[model samples]
Target: MSPQTDDVALSTTAERKVVVQSAGAQPDKDWVIVTRGLKREYDMGGEIVRALQGVDLAIRKNEYVAIMGPSGSGKSTLMNLIGCLDTPNGGEYWLSGQLVSTMKDDELARVRNKEIGFVFQTFNLLPRATALHNVELPLVYAGVGSAERKERAMEALTKVQLGDRAMHRPNELSGGQRQRVAIARALVNRPAILLADEPTGNLDSTTSEEIMRVFETLANTGQTVIMVTHEPDIAAHARRVVVLRDGKIASDERNQKVTSSLGL
Candidate 1:
């Protein structure tokens, strides 16, 4: 697939309008994820630590974006909010046309299950389960039947080119293979977005490139992937990079030269 760019310019005015819009209104279909004036704070030792301070972001469907920043730049907080793992104290978060920021915990949990697929740095697979079984876990949680779950899991594994290792456990797989299995598990549910947090953090340089190629393939296939990483080289794998600083967006730009998996 040919490389693409995020043509939507950053408009604070538009973001503010989306923020002030009446709650429960569906976002425009073009935007798969939107955050307006998103804010989050933590109480630390009787002092308040403002992690995210009114962040406004918009991501369209099939966008391969990287959220990058130094430590304490609020990228992690932004990721948590985007992933629906945490809610912003202020502002509206819309995911796949739904206003998810206002959702309750249980509702958010359901939304996470139905709308988001997560790949963590640790490759959080069940140590005892085979790659196929690990991939099947999400469908199981969704109450899918046995046969269909297995079939979908296998197909997802096949997408990552790990079909032959479906029966292998995490302990039996290499670091890259385990991450691929995790990616397969994330894709099994066909979620609206694949959210990866420091996906290649645990791998060596060679293995990291291997995992990156899998992500590259997924992005080429129209997957909306948002990866949170501090490493510039890893972030370069994404077509667009958004850098956060001092709890706000410092820079958002397209990478003119996206890195290829083949190291061209």
Candidate 2:
């Protein structure tokens, strides 16, 4: 992640974020994400279902936040919108100063490719590919030259302290290492934000903590991270936690636990 300009003040407190979101305007570039009255709906057998009634969120660069909710809380819908996988029906969503809600499919695809790096619960690595090769997948898709792709992939892997494991296959590496490889791949593009959906779901408790520590290191290095999960303990690993209920944010607060524990 690149260092953000000092010209913009940090929106650290929930009160500050409220001020930013309530402005109902596109935030400046320093604020990487802003939403006003974001909404999502579905029609099931002629019955209308409101997955998200109205969601207003503001996130600045280099913040590590977690979005957590129980089943039917619309957290997934919010994640999709933030990840650029889906658009809201009636709201404004601005990402890095662009109105994402109005972008067409092609534009959304490009934005997704350029701005967001995603980590799924499933590592999603090619079984036959080595860790280095797996980390090169995104660059390969972007048509990056082979030499540059390999170089960037190695740099990404080194960020997660996995450079030594680059040539190991997924089956040969432990679950934690494989997840680290996935995280490295996500970081290869130097996206503005890293969006992870239940990234530690498949790992054991110890391995999960290992992955969280990697995230902690990344956040310390100025990576903007947004994690969506149902587990409170996992959410506690983030510097800020936003809980959603009934399709709206129920609470947003700084996590003293993570802040003090991680020296952030």
Candidate 3:
């Protein structure tokens, strides 16, 4: 399908996903993902549907930010656009100082693989593969040697406290462990930014809290994290919150304590 068509599909899928995964809902100073007047429209049954009207956002590197809004609020559309999995119909997007808005689909994919680490709500782990294998997939795409890929994957798993589970398949691990594996996979590349769409959507409260702690640790270590969430409590864990309403930012504020405590 065409890039435009792909963007539309992602919007529709995102809108639907936003309904069930609603949960809690970023940073400033050194913005890593910036967007201005971003818009996305779809030709649905010959009618146009606007997913994002105009969204303006700025996320800083090493900052933990959450995107929150109600169903049909265009939060998911914003995630897709920011993740570089899809592009906007009209807007200016600068990711790590690069004009991603103008890149072709292939170029976007290459940049995404090189600069972004994505963690999905579903964990997105390969069902039959060992955690080590799944975590190494990105390196394989980047053409890293097998020996180096194994070393890097193991190092990532260790960072997430999952070194012992590396030989286990997704099905063999618990929900929290699986998510950690996914997180390890995302960090394996050490991308410019980590984009997580409902990263803890499927986990229980306790598990979710554990995941948030991991994110906190990541941000503390200077890893940029941008997550989309619907629950206010979950969003509270972030250093900054960007509230979206009908695709426009309604509020942007930092948790002074979290921000100051970490010096982020």
Candidate 4:
């Protein structure tokens, strides 16, 4: 797995595993995400497919990390685990201090709704709903009052620079504006982490760059973001890049260019 050229700031393997190696205990509050020997598998008929093989990772609060890999490299599986959308077959996962790898499906659902904000390639907006309504859906599901939901939804829209388009339907917005709305919706809950899966996959190059700038702004403002992308150019926008190969991490290093640009 070749990442775009750069000098790695992490000089030793030990440094990379410092937090990951702390097994059998709750991770420090300094780490917003941690995985100790994380593993996931699926059964295809009678055959077993191991998607993740003892993956150990640590991400602190406010860190912007990009996960990169080939199609079968298990990045998606790892994302699902980190997002609490799926439980692993083996090992421990801690997100915002909760050990979620052992949580039941119902419990996992609750944590996922409260802790992970997801932005997808498809935007996933309701075609008939206004941008404000789409952003309000999460709060609505959380049983928030209409007044409060509207206020928070507007705030989220403003964060993504979409407040002026709040009343517009998805069809009334450009591709970039729609994605911005999706980003606004994801931020409405102020989740512990924002997990984006190929967020630029559907957009043109210019629009993708626009969205990446939004992510950069959010990360600079202390929001933790985890983006899974295949393109090196896209991953380069992140301050750190983690490349996965054959279900394991092949390299995890800082992207000096982006890190320096962000002054992080």
Candidate 5:
């Protein structure tokens, strides 16, 4: 695949994202994400289902964090809120110091397109689109011009070492390669946070490790990453782990930084 082709691919609307990172964008400053008294509820046949109840979280810029919990524990709901895919029934959410919860639909959509990049459990690439086009989807929606958009997209693909497979479609690639392409798509927009939900759910152990390595490289480059996974092995790759239970934070702890500590 030519680098030029990789750069010009179309946009894929995964979750919402907005661009909050700039050189003067508080490089060393902490706190890229913050939430207070967060809550989300749903009505089912006139019954209330509380997905999250009074959750509070603070994440710093460039931090690698993971949210872990069993099904029905609100992990996915929290991820959606964080990813800006959905709004909460009650609470405050701040992204790069902007109040996301208070924004209207158009404002929220802009924030999501520019500030956050999302990776799904299924990869979510368009079946008919080539890998490069899939990665370029976000840039297209942001009103980026063709030439510049292609350049940025290609750069992102290169970051994940997928520059050579830009022309291949999802069906033509292996599971690991497909996920790598998805990761490239997530990074293409250079969002403030790369939000991933069960990114390794469909991959085998070796492939999963390969995917995590891409994440590690991203973190090393000062990318803020927040991933949701239930597997302990996958969570171990994160710098810190936060466990949710019964719609609340059960435990939050710093995992060993083996990557940085051992220079892996």
Candidate 6:
């Protein structure tokens, strides 16, 4: 099926409900991610902070989704949970058909390494490492051989149109180039979901659009992407937008205008 068809199929409220309901049964491969009644809370000096309250989110394979919210709206918390950086205090999280919310630290680490590719707002490339080396870091952690890692890293850099800059260090590149390297690093792992948190936050408007175009291409080519951002314009690039308020989902809608504008 075409990417456009997939986008429309997943946008319907009925389809979303089906995916969410399937989360409790045997996992469906079509649903790349599912969170059922997910909840998170924290205690600070005897005061409780509820970061997430029963958030039910289902993202299908090849979906391009943006999770948006204002400050203190729990978008960051939800991103953490989805990325396996943090586990929920209650409820379930299934990624690639595996229940991961209750996984141990080491198990979580393994799942994170295998299932999620994360791009951060700060462009978290190693300062001293070359772009190629930075992109190879995840493969190194996975115990891939040096030659294979190098090959895959080079391929990822080429995907981002940074093949010629493989030897360049982060400091040697412009902000846009650095973010491209970070994106290459994220994609090098061939993860199930590309989870980007404020990926273009540090860049100027022009650079942000450049990165969004890269994301758009990836999504069009059947990559599953979940982005967390507060900027409406940035979020608009996604095919679907889910807004959060007071630790709950306020609205979920298809961005038909943005979708058509991007030719997705």
lDDT of 5 by residue, 1-264 (tens): 223321221111121111222212332235677777789998999999999997777777777889999999999999989988889999778788887877888888888889999888899999999998998899998999989888888888888888898889999999999998888888888899999999999999999999999888787677889999999999988877889998999987667554355444
Sliding window of 10 residues with minimal summed lDDT for model 4: 1-10
Q: Over the stretch 28-138, how does candidate 4's per-residue lDDT look in tens digits?
A: 776788899999999999999999999999887777899999999999999989988889999999999889999998898778778888899999999999999999998
Pairs of colliding residues, candidate 1:
none
Q: Rank the candidates by TM-score, best first.
A: 6, 4, 1, 2, 5, 3
The whole-model C-alpha lDDT of candidate 3 against the native structure comes to: 0.80
Q: Write the per-residue lDDT of candidate 6 for residues 1-264, one digit (tens) a residue.
A: 476656543657777787777546746788898899899998988999999999988888888999999999999999999999999999899999999998999998888878899999999999999999999999998999999999999999999999999999999999999999998998898999999999999999999999999998998788999999999999998889999999999999988777577563
CA shift at 142, candidate 5, in angstroms?
0.6
Distance from true position, residue 32, model 5, in Å? 0.8
Q: What pairs collide in candidate 6?
A: none
Among the numbered candidates, top lDDT falls to 6
Top model number, TM-score: 6
The models' CA-based lDDT, in order, is: 0.87, 0.87, 0.80, 0.88, 0.81, 0.91
Model 4 spans > 4 angstroms off? 1-16, 260-264
Q: After superposition, how far is residue 229 of candidate 2 from its true place, in Å?
A: 1.2
Model 2 weakest lDDT span, ten residues long: 1-10
**TM-score of candidate 5 on Cα atoms, chains taken together:** 0.86
State model 4's lDDT.
0.88
TM-score of each: 0.90, 0.90, 0.86, 0.92, 0.86, 0.95
lDDT, residue 244, candidate 2: 96
Choose 1 or 6, whichever is better by lDDT. Answer: 6
Q: Which sections of candidate 1 miss by over 4 Å?
A: 3-25, 259-264
Pick out the ten consecutive residues of candidate 1 with the lowest summed lDDT: 3-12
Measured with C-alpha atoms, the lDDT of residue 62 in candidate 5 is: 71
